[model samples]
Target: MARPVQTPAEVLGIEPAGAYHRLLLRAPGVAEAVLPGHFVTLAIGGRDSATPLRRAFSVHRADPVADTIELVFAEHGRGTRALARHRPGDTVDLVGPLGTPFPVADAPETAVLVAGGYGSAPMFSLAEAILARGGRVGFVLGAATADRLFGVAAARALTPHVAVVTDDGSYGARGRATDPLAAMIRAVGATVVHSCGPMPMLRAVTDVAVAAGARSHTAVEEAMACGFGVCMSCVLPVAGADGATRLVRSCTEGPVFDGTTVRWPEASPPEPSPSVEPREVREVREVWEVREVREGVRS
Candidate 1:
């Protein structure tokens, strides 16, 4: 069952890491409140103004005993910039535990985790979860350069089997992280692949996984407005079980989906209509709106 979405809590701590900040929030009574792959949505501005509502972020760490949840976000936009200015004891609005989590395949004989840029957040917890379940974990992280490569040390600490790839030669391999990922998968004979990253990297990883006949799951990074499914901003075309293509809302149905389920086009396809008369479309929209309203009231 889904956990009830909560209101924004107070900022407890802000630890800086390069250009990003690890924000610790106190959501009292929300103890043991989050699942491994769950995320939280935080409102940036005051309620009276046209606040950007809530921005969704993956829960990097959730400590129920401490009544705290942590989010690691980069300073990119107005909301994020504002978040950077917040000090301890400041209150911020939030609503969450949204969306389905990445499927945890039981100790997949051998598993490989591939992440790029900020995409490492979700994969980090996922790796830890898998390890706790007795699964062997290997990591392949790609970044623009050594400076942009975050979480390598942490990932390495979790498992000795880690490979870093950078666009520049400042890191492990001079090529993209996918190069090392492919190499590592081949060398270790990885059976399952989990990835979260840029679209190009995801596509590349999908191709590699498909060629190797490995089951792969991908966590997508898309623009989301309503952390629930209401906004329709994060819908992507996916191939359904019936072989027909359908649009799936990323916020609700998935931020993480099986790579094979996505309808990848060879060339740029035409945009899908926002208002289709299909029953499924209507149902999806309705469900999303209801969830949004419920979340709004809680916030």
Candidate 2:
């Protein structure tokens, strides 16, 4: 992994992506270093705004040739709304390719990827990486509605084995993404599963993967006040290799972890100040109409 660098990255473009926005930036160093599941933090609200905190976003895509990176997010709060206001050629302070990346298998194998809403951002690149390694990939994507679900076309372009679900039945099925997960794993004889989404969905994915005896990797959507692991706001009690549960920072030690090892919370905790990971509880329940974010942008 490469060390992170803080730079004043120039905005290359911003466009509407269904209910979300896709931001592109000229971030050579960050873009070059970022891998699947790695994220970046952006200082929001400008230099003299009320919200001084940064927002984190998972990397949607990084183009080393173009020296650019792309991020997908919903402008539901003050910070993101401010970020959405940025125009091409504008500059934003960026820090990243931070956090642990999703570990890819050294040898090609059958795999499945699960994503919810914009959480699908990181999964596409991950799929490409897996495919490049001669691995087979399948995708399970879900959202509240068809409009909210992302990357179906992209996923299809990657592989024919794609399943889509929506809460209201406006898409493939009227259910959560996890609904068909087990069957997908069984169908493909997948040995590995990867996911990026709200906390609850990740927990469910872990359960299904574990039940199917597949190794699972999940990129958590925890709110981070500091993307460098200093604020301690993104800690989650995770079971370590020795069977002891310890609080781990999502920004540093993970954003991606062994799904079977996470100690899932009994109940949804209070939605953290909206900072990074757009597919959290707030978006699931409220549809991202109104919310405040905290740590810098991830994607």
Candidate 3:
């Protein structure tokens, strides 16, 4: 059965690190059903405005005994920035424990988790669940710089096999996370790969895992208005069971999906805009004028 949405949750505490923040909330109903990889939509200020209707954030931690749920989010846009203004003992409206979770391995298996930026939020709980079931786990985290890499130290506490990658060589590897991830999968022979990041990165991980003959799953992020299935705003194209392409709701059906089932399109060259003239045509007159000027100067 679906859990009821809880609004007006009391803020238990606030913890800030770099650009990211963790808000611990006490809401009895939410604490019961929240699982790893599940998310909640928070309505800031209890307002009905379009900007702050509800913002979805992953469940960083859930303690049923204490009736508390923790949400770790980066201050990205308007809604999140507003959420950052909140302090302890304040009330915030929320709705959730929504979306399908990553498939739990039925047996002992090697699992690799890859995350980019704040995408790491959902994987912590997943790692804990896997560890409890005696599953072997490893992690690969990627960020633009070391300062942006949140939760790497905490993740290391759970597993020793953690690799950090930064784009500008500020921390670990001087390349994207996909580079080390592919290397790790090859060396460790991971049985299953789970990833959450930007679409391009997720696509790259999917390709690498597929080529290596490893089963993989991905958590996709998209614009979601309503956390429930009613809004239909978070639809994404997916291959149906009949091999035909159809749109699926990212909110209800999944934020997590099998990588193999997704259809990736072939790369194509950039198309010129209809309103813009050809570059060669524009450069021809400029070249003629430059040559005339050069001849005049010589004379």
**Which tens-of-lDDT digit does each residue in 108-150 have in candidate 2?**
9889999999999999899999999999999999999888988
Error of 3 at 283 (Å): 39
Ranked by TM-score, the better of candidates 2 and 3 is 2
Models, CA RMSD each = 7.7, 6.3, 12.0
Off by over 4 Å in 1: 29-31, 49-51, 266-299
Which ranking of candidates, highest lDDT first? 2, 3, 1
For model 3, the stretches where C-alpha displacement exceeds 4 angstroms are 1-4, 48-52, 264-299
Off by over 4 Å in 2: 266-268, 271-299
Model 1 per-residue lDDT tens digits across residues 1-299: 24656776989899887557889998875537676567778878777634444677877777889988888888865678888999999998777777777777665466788988767877777887777777778899988877677788899899888998889878788888678776777766778788887767877888888778778888777567777877776666777788866677777877777888875552112334466555334444554554454334334
TM-scores for every predicted model: 0.84, 0.89, 0.85
Q: Which number leads on TM-score? A: 2
Question: Which candidate model has the greater lDDT, 2 or 3?
Answer: 2
- Descending-TM-score candidate ranking: 2, 3, 1
